[model samples]
Target chain A: MKLKELAHSRTGDKGNISNVSLIVYHLEDYERLRQAVTAERVKNHFKDIVKGEVIRYELPKMGAMNFVMQEALGGGVTRSLSLDRHGKSLSSYLLEMEISLES
Target chain B: MKAIRIGGGAGYAGDRIEPALDLMEKGNLDYIIFECLAERTIALAQKEKQKNPSKGYNPLLEYRMEKVLPLCVSKGCKVITNMGAANPVGAARAVKEMALKMGLQNLKIAAVTGDDVFLNIEQYLDSTIMETGKPLRERYPDIISANAYIGAEGIARALKEGAHIIITGRASDPSLTVAPLIHEFGWEWTDYERLGQATAAGHLLECGAQVTGGYFAEPGYKDVPELWNAGFPISEFSENGDFTVSKLDEAGGLISKATVKEQLLYEIHDPENYLTPDVVADFSQATVEEISANNIIIKGISGKQKSSYYKTSVGYQDGYIVEAEISYGGSGCMNRARLAEEIVRKRIAYTDLSYEELQTDFIGTSSLYGEQTSTNLIPEVRLRVAARCEERKEAMAIGQEVEALYTNGPAGGGGVRVHVEEVISIASILIPEANVRVDVVFEEL
Candidate 1:
């Protein structure tokens, strides 16, 4: 299963920093996410776009996780020359992450 | 027993005004705050104000006020807004005149100023750009607008003065709601923990309908009903700083823990220390619970402390941005799109149209996930070319080159759209909080 099967994501940008929040549909799936979605994997996934470090923060209360990508946007919404300056589609990219279902 | 219901009106400068009107009509609210100013919006507004002294406020100020003022006055709901982008006094005056014209004779409007540092530009003569750490004098010839993000003290003072509508210039977006929470709850400025909770509520509600499932709908997977008529958010802030987020009755949209959680982390840098003009909010410990259908309770928020300096947003003339798109389809669309891309690049290769940065991407094929994502060729694709230049005509020429691909090249190219926009970029720096002073003046009609 893909992350999209159990979660939905949203992207927000400020300057060159971009934060993508992943919210799971079921609380039972959070442990699966905690085991699968590691910060190193996220940093490796966005290594092409983001120039700086990727930090992941856990929110067990809301069953959500925030991945902060530094230097993710080309420059940002204001300074980036890319078509998707705000990187709004980046959330969809995070949702593309594949997750193994619990047997 | 001290509780106030406030609605988030306009999130951005050009967000839907009808939702705000609907919020006022049906939300049973005591106050509605419209957070309309973005980082670069004030610079653009300053350009307008330089052109016309009486203008430079929000573009939809009259239309929004004309639609909501009558209802707000009747309900006695206090209105707080940062629609006074470059000119608070002018916005207040505009609102006052509109109220009188609408036969609302007893409206009391207040304007908060002292955010702009144009009058004291010399103080930053030796200052450095916060992002790049470069000297300010070396970058650009002009600084369009240098305004600091202020706190909620002036707004609380305005409410104490009995102003029904408070218009502000360059105030922090969250402070618009935080101010009202302070005034109504009699919370002190030094109450960091309580202020953080209120700031969290303000942050949750500042983006209008964003926290109420408007931006959370994804159709099949994350489904939401009646998204077309999605209602804006309204928060009931208690004296203890706990709040319930909900919308108007019979309005569309969902307000569950999922929506609130997505919003809680929006654009936030550090969850342990979220900085604002008012407080250093820590939402890490905050608890969210769904108490009813389309209503969630948010509580347990805390704060560290606020910094002694305020963040100043400075706008400058970066350059001009030009974008042109040409779509190709039918038989050999991807090939034609590639040909179109090459043609645009070659045509503008040797011209005087010097661009600082240029980018190209195929919309249907390689826009987001890169070229590796699409193994099979698509039937259709959009070839988009964007360039940043120092001159308007040069930027326009970049578009003209792409538009020429219809007759000059590309067999199946159709639907050519081009845009040339002024790029007013922004930078930030911090200054002493004590250096900036805020004053609230009222006007009655």
Candidate 2:
């Protein structure tokens, strides 16, 4: 299954960093999300785009996780030559991350 | 327990004004905030100021003020905005002039200045730029604009002085919403908890429609109704700091727990350390509950003492970027697009166009993901070539090379478009709070 089945995400950018927040649809799925979507996994998922380190912050109360990717947005929005300067569509790309369903 | 109703007017510099006008007309707002300045917008505005002294503010200030000023005056609603960009005084002056022309009286317009730190750039020459980890002196000559992200103190002071409209340059986006809360409730600068809560409310409202269903829609997954005419957000805050997010009943959009939650963490890195000039707001334990349709209560947001230094955005001339696109269609369109990309790259190298970096992308297949994208032959594809160069002429050559593909190469190529724009990149640095002094100048009409 894909992470989109249990979660939705939103992407925001600041300078060369892009932060994507993944929120679970239900609180019950939060634990599973926390286990599956690690910072290492996120870093690997965006290895091509993000050149720097990825730091993940947990919002357990809100059943969400925030991933901050440095050296993203192709060196920031104002200077980047990328088509999507802000990398706003990164949330959708993150949603495509495959998640193994709990048996 | 008096609750003050505040409406988010414009989210960014070019946001729609209709929703804001709707708030003033029907939402019964005590204050309306327009958070218009983005990270690099003020820097670009500075370039404009250099060319013309009188014009550095948001270009839409007159058009927006002309429409909302009368409504605000008649309804006794105060206005706050960072639409001043590089020049708050000029923006305030423009608003005062427009208000007088519109025959609106008893309006006290305040221009909050002192955010611009270019005059005292020498003092920060030794400071390290957070982005590049380099000394400020390294990029001193290339620096175009340097403005410190000021707190709500100046805005609160303006409100205290009975300013009907406040214009500011480079104030933190959330501070636009937080200022009125401080003024209304008389919250002290040292009150970290209340400041934190207010900052959360401001953050949620800062994006306007983002918390009201504009960016929350997903066709089959998370459906939002009437998103086309999605309304901007309005929050009612009690003196104690708890607030409820909602929109006009007749307005289009959703204000569910989901929308609010998504926006709560939007652009935020750590929920616990969401830094603003006013406070270091903690949203980790914040709770969102749907009290009713289009009404959600946000609570449990706390704050800590703010940092001693103010985060400053330094804008410099990065160079020029030229982007050119051409579409191809047919059975082998993907191959044709790749061929065009190769042709452009070879042509640029052959012509010796001096560029720092260059990239070629097939729009439909791999423009966004690059090499990671799966290659599948598609019926149509758009070939896009973009290059960054120090000189404008070098940037123009890349675009010209792409445009030449219409008649020079690729079968069935059509709809070629090219754009060459000067890049104004931003860097972050910190300045001591004491070094930056904020002053509010008032103009009464």
Which DockQ values do the candidates obtain, in the order shown? 0.64, 0.83
The top-ranked prediction according to DockQ is 2
Query: How high is the CA lDDT of each candidate model?
Result: 0.86, 0.90
Best by lDDT: 2
Location of the lowest summed lDDT over 10 successive residues in candidate 2 chain B: B370-379
Top TM-score model = 2
After superposition, the stretches of candidate 2 with alpha carbons farther than 4 Å from their true spots are none
User: Which pairs of residues have clashing backbones in candidate 1?
Assistant: none
Error of 2 at B281 (Å): 0.9
Tens digits of per-residue lDDT, candidate 2, B1-445, equal 9999999998788999999999999999999999998999999999999999999999999989989899989889899999999999999999988988888889999999989999888788898988778898887789999999998999999999999999999999889888988888887788998998888888888899999998889999889888988999999999877899999998999999889889998899888998888899999998888889999998899999889999999998888999999999988888888899889989988998888888777888887877787577577889888888999999988898888987898898999999999988888899999999899999997
Please give the RMSD of candidate 2 to the true structure. Answer: 1.1
Residue pairs that clash (backbone atoms under 3 angstroms), model 2:
none
Candidate 1: deviation at residue B412, Å? 2.0
User: Model 2, chain B: what is the TM-score?
Assistant: 0.98
Per residue, candidate 1 scores C-alpha lDDT tens digits across A37-75 of: 988988877766778889998877778888999888876
| TM-score of every candidate relative to the true structure | 0.96, 0.98
